[model samples]
Target: MDAGLTPVRVVGAGPVGAVCALALAQQGVPVCVLEAQPETARGDSRTLALAQGSRLILERLGVWSRLADVTPITRIHISQRGALGVTRLDAGDLNVPALGYVLSYAELAAALKQALRDADVAVEYGIAVARIGASAAAAELATADGRTLATPLAVVADGGRGDDAPQPRFERDYDQMAVVCDVQTELPHAGQAFERFTPDGPAALLPKGDRYALVWTAARADAERIAALPDTAFLTALQAHFGGRRGRFLEAGPRKTFPLKLTWTGSEAGNRVVRIGNAAQTLHPVAGQGFNIGLRDAWELAALAGDTPADALGGAAMLAAYARGRRADVVGGLGFTDFLVRTFSNDLGPLRHARGLGLLALEAFPPAKRFVARRMMFGANG
Candidate 1:
């Protein structure tokens, strides 16, 4: 290692990367964060339904308190468009304060960034990692700025196609678009979130202060058409599709749309390098599993890294243990979400009934419901 070298270097400044950096810094580890963009870029384009388990992780890292403008999800109500079954999970039944929370992406990113600054962690902004080269002893990150950062260990949190990709990724276009926006409803959300499965796809309404942040997934062509509708027409159409569960959607803000996809890869940790967050895998948005899983990845990696000897920051044994520890949760999260999207997205009559019955069964079986909630809350182990 070079004299006075940083112990760890993390790429990407998104919530996952920021939280990962904060975890290490909280452990008194010397680390630096590199962001592709300069400063913190705040956005209101999307909202995240953070699981109860994720709040615990963020709280442990001291970033949770920094977040504001979030609304607790007291319950999660699940139902199908034409089905008679309905399943609802209540936080009170589980003796928890909340099942989840609706957080705007900007709120989370800002909180983590602020926590990073307070910890005196160094963050190099506007520097993108163009390439990463690893050896048994050390790792080097080459940047788009024609500069290089050599460190004892490197954690890649940046997500995208790259030269040294970790595993073979499987991707599906899903032929869907997730149209997102915020709206005011005639009926209050009352801290409850709803997941309604339609013939075309799934739509979610999450409590966001006085409004509900709507993530309505639809077939690609339908999404384009819906997105192009005027605000009044769109809200009316949304109410028609979602039914009168929330009475009616009175008004809607501007909307945005993005193609939905299932892009996932395998886990890897070796040669003085590790990957976490979106760099590891990106799952379908159903069930809101991707970010929660990524948060666990960051937390687990930090715990392992915090316990390692400085001399073995990225040594084989340490890297191996990290890889082993994350395998179950990462694989489990990927499998769970993949299975869910495949099963529920189908509109066939038998499959539809099966899915509805599955929800009904989930409600009838307490143990089963608890098990699923725990898994969603705490990942593989829960």
Candidate 2:
């Protein structure tokens, strides 16, 4: 079979899947996207923190300019509550225009959808896959509507939440939940973000348009209590937990909570069937590595596909190569997030002191700080 004549079937039309499809289409690889949700599905209100590297990828795909209300992160302040050590990362020091950008997930999804249409990529909405399997010849998919399809390659980016999703080879329950909402602070953000590590968990505030998007991590029970608090009480609890760094949290939007965990499918999967984004691995949202890693996964896969000969698009060798190339970034991201969650989300006296010293050491060393900052902006390679 001529691989060029067989379009790649991308499952899930979310940001990660859309990126992979757009990149593939731009590389002249025939591609089509299948989204289970209808075109009129409600927009996602979740906010996203995109690193500069992701910005470059979207720019290359010609979708960056289409986004709206994106707020740049000029600086990030990281510290441990009730500790003596603190460290800050400045975009100016790093010589980057901005470390990252914050925007609603819906905005990014809309831009990618529009870009797909402009690139002439075929997208089938409201088509839920009943099963996705792989064979030496091709990747096969069965839809709920009794339709069957086969392609040289199939990309899964549905976040592994579907009934047919693959079971994760590795999983860890953190027993923590994050209370998230948009908050108005007494003081202006001015593009400054905060990562305050507490004994319970890490609390993060990303600068959004004229406000901040808060992800306050705590024990499951505590998070539920916080999320259920009335608006005024919620703001007061937030101020108490996060401190006066941004002054009192004046107002808060609707609060939501999600459990935190680390799940990975490993590098190896079915032949010619690749998983990207949350479909492959979902990590704790401590350092915001999971989503960016997913973007890198999509970008690199598309690049490698473009380089490989059409006849070997999803051959065993190609899959092996893809796995090898992504190992470092994937493992690095997983390890980094896991380490932060375990190491900092505690209150052992000795460990707390050690963490404080570590922060102080990192702050004193310019090169080390830059290295970590770049890794956050890029990946392990950076």
Candidate 3:
């Protein structure tokens, strides 16, 4: 069969899968993407914060130039709710153009969709992977529509949870739901971001153009209550929790809620099958780490085909090298998000004071601030 006819299959056409397909197509490797959502389906309204490092990778894949309506993040402010702990990071201090950028899901999806068209990467809409079967030669993708696709490599980027997964994954339900929405502040964001940790959970307001995209992570009960709030009441409550740092919360758009959890495979999937993106790992919205790490996953996986023949795409050698190259990053990203969630969601007296002092120290000490800022801008290695 022609390689284009049996292209490496990418399950789930979300950012990760789309990036994977495009990266391969850019390298003259054929790819087919299976998207569960229909062409006309509405995108989730949540906004994502793309780190500086991710921008470079996207540029390499030729996706960044296609993005529209992005809001840059030049500085970040961090604090504990109603506490003296405060730390600020500026792009100038780090000597970078911007720390990050905020983008709506719809804008990003549209960009990737267009890129897919330009690259002529085949995408089958409304086709979800119901199950996967692996063999010595190819990975079998069983679709919900009762069709089967056989390909040398199968990359699963759908958010985890499948009985058909090749290996066991550790799961942690935070018992939290994130309330996402857009809000108008009395003061312009000026490309600044704020993350305030309440005893309940973490709340982050990222600059989105002139407004702010609010991601409020709270306990399930609290999230439900917050979601049920009337517009006037919601604004008041948000103002109280976030304080007046960004001035008053003038108005808000519609709000949505999504449960928070961390699901990650304990090890790599078996031969000829690989999982990347949320299928391999899902993180809390603590530091906006999930998609960035997933994008890197897509890029690394694409690099495996550099000088190798098409027949060996998912052969033992390729899969082994991929696992070795990715394990450290997977471990590091998981540890990074988990630590932020635990450290900030507590209110114990000693720990509270320690965190406050730590924040003070972070601001006072340039080296420590640079270390944390670098990690945020890049990854664990920074």
Candidate 4:
């Protein structure tokens, strides 16, 4: 088969998969994306915080300008709930235009969908993947609609699967659910994102225009109870937990809940298959790094595919190279998010004091603050 005519088959139409398809198509690589749902299907309404690095990737892919209107995060604040001190990070401090931007998941999907259409990438919505098989020559994907796609490379961005594959797996269950929603507060957020770690879990308030996006990671029971609260009751509960940081919470929007866990899939070299995004790893939402890291995977893999020789596109050597390129980032991000969730989620006296002191030190010391800021804005590599 002619290399230029051969397309890459991507499973899933979530943000990660769509992003991979878009990046590859932009590089003149043909792509076929299979989505299990219709194009009009409503996506999860949660909000995502896009780090500076993620913003750069979207800008390179030509989708950031269209999303500029809805992206509102520019600063971040970190502290324990009811703590006397808070550490703040500003985009200006790092000499960047913005630390990060907050985007609604649905809006981002819409933007990427439009970009994919404009690029003329092939997308088959409402088609489920029945099975996947691969060999030395090409990978094959069978869909529920009776369509078989043969491609040089098969990238699974659909998320982690139970069946066996080439990659090693590492997982951790937090037994927590992240309850997310929007809140209207009496005081302006001033575009500052706040993260407070309590014994229950980590709660974050990210600024979005006049309102704030609230992500509270709590025990399953607590998450359920909180999700069931009436708007007035929810506000009272939120104020009690969040304290007076953003003043009193006035009203809240609909709430949603999702389980929290950490997962990582090893790289497969000789199977003519590669997994990116959620298929590769899933992180705790405390640091807001899950989707951002997946975006990096998409951009990096696309770059690798664009540069590799036609005969080597899905070859063992090429796949291994890609894996090597992504290993540091994948491991580092997973470790960081894991540590943040475990370290902050505890109320042990000694650990609490140590964490509080650490925060104070980070605020008092510019070097330490800058280092943390750099890691947050960039990745481990940066």
Off by over 4 Å in 3: 1-5, 161-163, 166-168
Number of the top candidate by lDDT? 2
Tens digits of per-residue lDDT, candidate 4, 201-231, equal 9999988867899998999888999999999
Clashes of each: 0, 0, 0, 0
lDDT accuracy of residue 102 in candidate 1: 91
Residue 271 deviation, candidate 3, in Å? 2.2
Error of 1 at 199 (Å): 2.5
Count of backbone collisions in candidate 2: 0
Best by TM-score: 2
- Residue pairs in steric clash, candidate 3? none
lDDT of 3 by residue, 1-382 (tens): 1454568888888888898889888777778899888977766788989989889988987889988689999999999986788999999998999999999988898888888888888899988889988898888988999999898888888766555765545778888899999999999999999999888899999999779999999999889889889999999999998999888999999999989888777325346888888888889988888888888888888877655687788888888888888877777888888888888887888878888999999999999999887777777655
Per-residue lDDT of 1-33 in model 1, one digit per residue for the tens? Answer: 223756599988788888888888777678888
User: Which 10 consecutive residues of model 2 have the lowest summed lDDT?
Assistant: 1-10
Candidate 4 lands at a TM-score of 0.95
TM-score of 3: 0.95
